[model samples]
Target: MLKMTKPREDETRTSAKKAGVITLTGQLAKALVQLAGLIAFSHLLTPRDVGLIGMVAVFLLLGELIRDFGLSQAAIQTAELSHGQASNLFWTNALVGLVMSASLFVAAPAVADLYNEPALSSIAPWIAVTFTINALQMQFQVRLARDFRFLTLTLTDVFSQLAGLVLGLIAALLGAAYWALVVQLLVASATLLVLRAGTARWVPGAPRREAGMSALYMFGLHSGLAQLVQYVASNADSFTIGIRWGAAPLGIYNRAFQIFSAPANQLLAPLTNVALPILSRQRHEGRDFYPLLLKAQIAISAALTFVFAVVGSLSEPLVRLALGSAWRESAPLLSILSIGGAAQALSFMAYWAFLASGNARQLFLHSLVTKPILAVAIVLGSVWGLTGVAWGFSLGLVVSWFISLGWLAKCDGMPARVFLSAGLYVLQSGLVTGAVLWLLNSKFGDHAPSVVILSIGFLAGGAIYATLLCLRKSNRTVFRSVLSPVAARVKPLLQRN
Candidate 1:
C-alpha cells in the first residue's frame, strides 16, 4: 500500500503543475480568440444585435446558474467523492437543465414583453436550447475539472469558441438577422458535445443516493446562491439599460463594460479554476492556506489595478479607434466602471477563500448585503440615464470591495493588513497611471495621435508602479513569494527596475 501510494502522490504533484500551466495558457488563448471574435462580429452586427443577444443572455445566465445549483463545484471540491456521487449529480444536473430550458422556451414571449422588445420574443427561445445542450455535458465536464485535466479543458473551449465565431460570421454574411444568434448557440452546443466525449472518463449509471453527500450539497447550495446574487448584481446595470435606454444605449454600455471587465476577468478566471481544487485539497490536509492565498491576492490585485487604471484613462481613444464613433457614449461609462472593475478583481480573491474554507454561507450573506446596495445605486443612477447607471453600478462595486476585505478577514482568516499593504501598491499605481494619462492627454489632444499616447502612458505607468512595488519592503516581499516559481525568468526584469 505504501509503495502504491508513493507513485500516486508523485503523479498528483505532476498533474497539479500541468493543470496550473494549462489554466494560464488556456486563459491567454481564449482571451485572444474572444477579442478577435468580438472585433470581427462588431463589424458585422449592429449594437442592436449585440443588445438583443445581451438581453437574452440575462435569462441564459440565470438558467445556467440555476441548472448548476452548485453540484459540479461540490464534486470538484470533495476529496472523498465516489463514482456513484458523480453519477447521481450528473443526472440531477441534466434533469434541472432540461426543466430550466423548457421553462425559458415557454416564457420567452413574456420576457420580451417585459423588456418591451418584440424581436426578443423569438430570439429568447432559440437561446434557451443552449441550456439543454449545456446539460448534456455538465457531468462529463465536472469530472474533467475534478482531476484538473485542463489541457483537454482548454482545447474544448478554444475549439468550441472557434466554431461559434465561424458560424456567427457566416450567418452575418448571409444576412440572417437575429437568427445568427441561433447559429452561434448551435455551434457552441456542438462544441460541448465534442468536448464532453473527449474529456469525460465516467459514464452515467443508476445513482446511489448517499448519506454523506449532504455536507457537499449544503456547501454547494450556498456557494451557488452567493454566485447567483453576485451575477444579478453585476448585470443589474445591463438589465436596467436594456429596458429603459433600449438596445442602442444598452449596447454601448455592455460593450464598454465587457471590454473593461475582460482583462481582470480573464486574469483571475484561470487562477480561480486552479485555486478551488488545490485549496480544497490543502484545506482537507489541515494546512495553512492564508499565506498562499494572500500572496496570490497581492500579485493579482496590484497588476489588475495598474492595468485597469491605464485602460480606464485611455478608454476614449481606445473606444474611438476600436469600436467607432457610434460607441462614444460608452467612454465615460467605461472609465467609471473600470474603477469597479479593478476593485472587483481585487475582491475576487476573497471568493476563493470563501469557497476553499467551505464558508459559502458567509459568502452568501455578503452578497445578500452587497446586491441590495448595488441595486439601490443602479436605481438611483438610471434616473439620469445609462451613464448614470454605469456610475452607480461601478460605485457599488468599489464599496463592496472594502466590505469584502473585512469579510475575508473575519470569515476566511486572511489577515486584513496584507490587503492594506497591497492596497497601497494599487493606489500608487493608480496615481502614476492618472498622471501619465493627464500628461499624454494634454500633449497630444484626445483624438490626435491618441494610440501612441495610450501606449506610452500604459508603459510608463506600469514601469513606475512596478518600481514602487519593488522598492516597498512589504509589497516586495509578498511579490517575491508569489512569483518565486518564475523568479529566474523575472529576475532580470526585477533588476531592470
Candidate 2:
C-alpha cells in the first residue's frame, strides 16, 4: 500500500494540517460572503429583476461550461506536468475564451430575443466580456488546486468574494438594476487576475509546444467532456424551468435551490478538491485507497446529510425568518432539492474513485449517460411546474447513484454489497432524521418555538445515528480506523461536550 512510509516530520505534518484548517476557514468565509450577497441582492432587487439576471445567468452558465475545456482538471490530474505544457494550455484557453466571449457578445441580441427581454440586449454583451478576463486566470487557479496549495487558494477566495460582496452592494446602492450582474462578473474576473498574479509560480510565454501538449490535450478532452456533461445535467433544471415557467417562477426556484445547494457547493467542494489531488497521488500504489476513499465518503456524507436533513425539514421557518414571507414559497423546493443534493454528495465522492484510478473516460461516460436521463426528467417534470421540476431533479440524482455505483464497484475491485451496506447506514440515518424532523415540524407546524425545539431534536438524531453506527460491526470497524489517529485529541472534546 502507498502509505506515508516516511513519517511526516513536525513541520510537514503541521503544514498538511494547515491545508484542511485553512480550507475550512476559506469555505466559511466564502459562504458568509455569499449569504450576505444573497440577502443584499434579494433586498435590493425584485424577483423580476433577479429573474431577468437569471435568464442571462443561464447563458453565462453555459459559457462557463464551454470555458471549462478541463484544462484545470488536466493540469491537476497530470502526475508530471511541465512548464511548456502549462504555458501551452494557458494560451489555448485564453484564445478559446476570447473567441467564446466575442461570440457571446455578438449573440446577445439573439439571447435577449429568445426570452423576449429587450433589456437583455445590452446586459448580455457586458456579461460576456467577463468570460474573456476569466479565461486569462483559469490555468493559474488550476495549478494551485493541483498542488493543494490551498493557503494560496484561500487568500484568493477571501479577496475575491470580498470584492464581489463590496461591488454587488455598491451596485445595489446605486440602483444599477441589471448592473448588479456586471458588478458580480467584473469582480470575479478582476479577482482571478489578482489571484493569478499573486499565486502562479510560472507564467506562460510563447510556446515551443512539445509532446506534453498532446498529452495535456488528451487529458483535457476527456476531462472537459465529462465536466461539460456534468454541468449540463446539473443545470438541466434551470434551462427547463426557464423555458416553461419564464423568469419569475424560475427565479424563485433557482433561489431556493441555491440556498439548499450552497453548503454543498461551498463547503463540501473543498473536501473533494482536497480528496481528488490526494487520491490521484495515491492512485497507483494504495491497496488501501479504495477502502480509505469509502470511509472518507461515509463520514463526510453522513455529516452533510445530518445537517441538510435538519435544515431541509425546518427550512420553512428558517426561510420565513431569514428571507421573510415572500420567500416562504421556496421552503418546499428547498426540501426537495436537499434530497437531490444528498444523492449528488454520494456520487461526487464515488466519482473520486474513478478520478484516482486515472479513468477520466469512465467518469465522462458515467455523466454522458446520466445527463440525458436527467435532461428527460427535467422535461417531463416541467409539465407540473416548479415543484415537479424539483422532484424530477432529485429523482435524477438517486437514479444516477445506482448506475455510477455499479461502475465504481467494477472498477475498484470492491464488493458492491459491502459498499452498499456501508452507505445503507448513512441512508438509514438520513431517512430517520428526516422522518423525525418532518413529523415534528408537521405536528407543531412552523411556530418559532418549534424551530428551537426541532433544532435540538435534530442534534439528538445525529447523536443517536452516530451511536447506532458505532454499534454496527462494519461502521464500528471504520470508526475505529478513523478514531485511532485522533482519539487522543478528540477525547477531550467529547468529554467536554
Candidate 3:
C-alpha cells in the first residue's frame, strides 16, 4: 500500500486527471463499438427479438450485482490490504459468482414464464454465465485501477468490446437472431476476463482467516446491498416496462434508454474508475477531495450533457439515422430520458464520494432512501404507459440528485456548490442548444436527410455551447481547465502531424 501527504496534492491531482483522460478515451472507443452494434442489430433484429433478450437482461443484471459483492470498490477504498485478504475476497467472489450463475440457470424457466416469452429459456442460461466470467476478474481489474494503470485498463476495455461486437455481428448475420445478443455479451465478458487475467496476473492463494476479514465483510455487505439497490433504482424502469408493456416496446425503450444513458455511462462513468483510488487516498489523508470531484462533474455536464441535449432535441432524425425509420417511437423516449441522464451524470460523484470515505453505511442508507423514491416514481409513471415511464424515470433521477446532495451535506465539502458551479450553467447551455436544434429539427427533420440533421446539430450545438462559454470570463476559465486533458492529447498529435 502507498501513503500520501498533504504536500503532494498537485502530484496526486495530475495523476488522477491523467488516469481520467486515459479511461475516458477508452470509454469513448467502447461507446463507438456499442453504437455500431446498436445500429447493426436494430437493422438485423426486430424489436421483439431484442426485446426478448431485454427481458432476460433484467434478471441477469441482478445476478451481476450479487457476484462482485462490492469487493472491487472496497479494495479501492481501503488503504491497506494483505495478499491473504485479496485471496479471500477473490475466492468469495468466485463462489458467489458460481452460485449466482447456477441459480439463474435453474430459474430460467420461471423468468421465461414471467415474461411470457419462451425464448428467454434459452437466452437466460448463457447470459447467466457472464456473472462468473466477470466475477473471476473483478479483482484483477481492481488491481490495475488501484495502481492507476489506466492505459492498460483502457486497452482491455476497447479490445474486449471490439471483439464482442465483431463476433456478435457475425452471429447476427448468420441468423442467430437474439442469441447473437447473448453471444455478444458472453464473448465480451470472456474476452475481458482473459485480457484482465493476462494483464493483472496475480494468483490467489487459498482462502484463510485474515486480520481485517470482519471489517472487510461488513464494508462489502453494505456496499454490495447499496449496489443492488442502485441497480434497482437504475433498472426498475426497464423491469417494469418489460413486465407491463411486454417485449416490443420494452426493446425500443431499452435502446432509447441506452442512448440517453450513453453520456453518463460512456462519458462520466469512467471518472469513477479513476477517482476512486485517488479519492480514497485523499479521504485517508484528511485532504479535501471535492475540487477534483467538482471538476469532473463540470467536464461531464458541459460536454456530455450538451451531446445528449442535442440528441434529445433532434432525436427523431438521430433515431432515423441510427436505428432506421421503423423505430421512430424511440425518439420521444430518448428526448424525455435525456433530462434524467444529465442529472445522473452529476450524481456519480456523490455516490463515489461516500465510497471514497469508506462510509458504506451512508452510501447504503442514501440508496435505500433515494432509489426507492426513483423506483416508486417509475412505477407510478408506468401507470400511464411507455411515455409515462420515461417521464417517471427522468424526473425521479433529477429528484434523486437533489436528495443525494442533501444526504451528503455533512460528509464532504458543499456538493450543492458542485451542482451550482458545474451543472447549472450547463443546464442553461443544454436548454439553449436544445431550443436551437428543436427549431431546426421541426422545420426539416421529417423531409431532410438524417445525416444532414445530425451534422448540423453537432456543429451548431457545439458552437453555441462553446460561444456561450466564451461569453463569461469565469466560465471560460473553468471550461479551459476542465478540457485540459483533451487539449494536451490533441496538441501533441497535431504537432506531430
lDDT of 2 at 262: 86
**What is the TM-score of candidate 2?**
0.90
Choose 1 or 3, whichever is better by lDDT: 3
> Ranking under lDDT, best-scoring first?
3, 1, 2
Q: What lDDT tens digits, residue by residue, belong to model 1 across residues 68-133?
A: 877777777776667777777777888888999899989989998988999888887778888877
Candidate 3 residues lying further than 4 Å off, grouped into runs, are 1-14, 413-415, 472-474, 483-497
Q: How many residue pairs clash (N, CA or C atoms closer than 3 angstroms) in each of the candidate models, in the order given?
A: 0, 0, 0
Candidate 3 or 2, higher TM-score: 3
| Model 1 per-residue lDDT at 14 | 32
Q: Is candidate 2 or candidate 3 better by lDDT?
A: 3
Q: Write the residue-wise lDDT of candidate 2 on 1-497 in tens digits.
A: 11222213342222333555567778888888888888777777777677778888877877766776877667776677667777777888888888878988999899887877788899888888877778888877766666556777777877787887798788889998768857886886788687766776757768674666776687678878987887787777887776666778877887798788888888666666566666676664554577667777776677678767777777776676566667678889998888877777787776777767777778788888887888788778878888888888889988888788898777666555666777767877787777887777777764547457556666776776677667777667766765575777888999999
Model 1, CA-based lDDT? 0.76
lDDT per residue for candidate 3 within 1-497, as digits (tens), equals: 32232122242223765677667778988899999999999999999988888888877889888998788888767888777888888888999999999999999999989988888888888888998998898888877676667777888888998999999999999999998988899899999999988987577789988788788888999999998998888788888988887999998998898788777777665667778888888878778887777766666667777887888999898898899987889999999998887788777768877888787988899899999888899999998888999999999888887887877876555557555656767777788888898999999887878999899888988899788756756567767876776788799999999
- List runs of model 1 lying over 4 Å from the truth: 1-18, 481-497
Q: Which candidate's lDDT is highest?
A: 3
Measured against the true structure, the TM-scores of the candidates, in listed sequence, are: 0.91, 0.90, 0.94
Full candidate order by TM-score, most accurate first: 3, 1, 2
